[model samples]
Target: MAIATFGLTNIHRRVDITEGGVLGMVLLLDHHFGIPPWALTTVLDAACYLLGWKVLGRDFLIRSGVATLCGAIFFRLWDATGPLLPNLSAQPLLAALLGGAFVGVGVGMVVRQGGSSGGDDALALVIAQKTGWRLSRAYLFTDLTVLGLSLTYIAPLRIVWSLVTVTVSSLLIDFVKTVGHSENRQKA
Candidate 1:
């Protein structure tokens, strides 16, 4: 999730596009209200963690905390090594696809392990638990809400691309989760 966050931000910077999760809200806040992404994300994620603790129990909190910490560390590490990485943004479409895939797989793996990487993932879990909806549907609902809010700040064309990224990521996350579940069932 952290590596994918880096890739998403890289694409956003290169192509003037935005993301569609909590990260997108962070970026929008930064753009429109002069808030810093790191600060906002920390506060928001902390609130989400607290909520998860209350609703999902202690195990979820602990695992999520670990995943969140790892994500933060990896994001910073990737930022520091940014110059060493090749520029993937040269092709915006490919960058978006790859970024979406990375995010999907990363988030999927974390969730499959009973952890969450951010507020978005926690929210999706909560929604799924409460409503009996699929995790992907929950993600789609929340992500689309954020993306819609983002239209106030982002260009229409960029928003279109962001939608594509979110859609692909959402589907892939479901795919990964389904496959993991099937494998675990097989093992059992």
Candidate 2:
């Protein structure tokens, strides 16, 4: 959560790059409605958690709760602070790549533990279970939906850059999970 927060504060916001899934929607709503991202994140995350609990079961809820709380708290803590790292607005590609790495590694760690750092995971899992879609397909569907909506506020070129970040993050997330799972299996 801290890494993801740092990426957003130091790079994404500076580069004017938007993300997908629930975070993207939070950014969109915050931009148009003057709602704080933390508030939006909490409400939206809680809503997804509720739905996920109903669909996925209590174990899922328990697993996600901690990371969800940490995410909200971390976002709140990181909320008002200025970027601690150098601004990467002038180098958008680098910003995008770094943003992807931060999110990928951070989220992958949570996911490997059978937890979620964001509502996107629960939502995607719910969608996958209910609709019989693969988890990857569900995630892609949600990401594309949010990215498409973001087009209203974000530029086409910027969205393309966002695609790059998403692609990198997705691949890295899978890589991390796969590698971690393999290592665990080998250890066992």
TM-score leader: 1
Q: Indicate the worst ten consecutive residues by lDDT in candidate 1.
A: 179-188
CA error at residue 153 for candidate 1, angstroms: 1.4
- Candidate 1 residue lDDT tens string, 133-184: 7777878898899889988877787787778778778877766776846432
What is the TM-score (0 to 1) of candidate 2?
0.78
Off by over 4 Å in 2: 29-43, 76-82, 129-136, 180-188
In candidate 2, how many Å is residue 86 off? 2.1
Give lDDT tens digits, candidate 2, residues 88-131.
88888898899888877777666666677778878876886787
Angstrom error at residue 36, model 2 = 6.9
State the C-alpha lDDT per candidate.
Answer: 0.75, 0.77
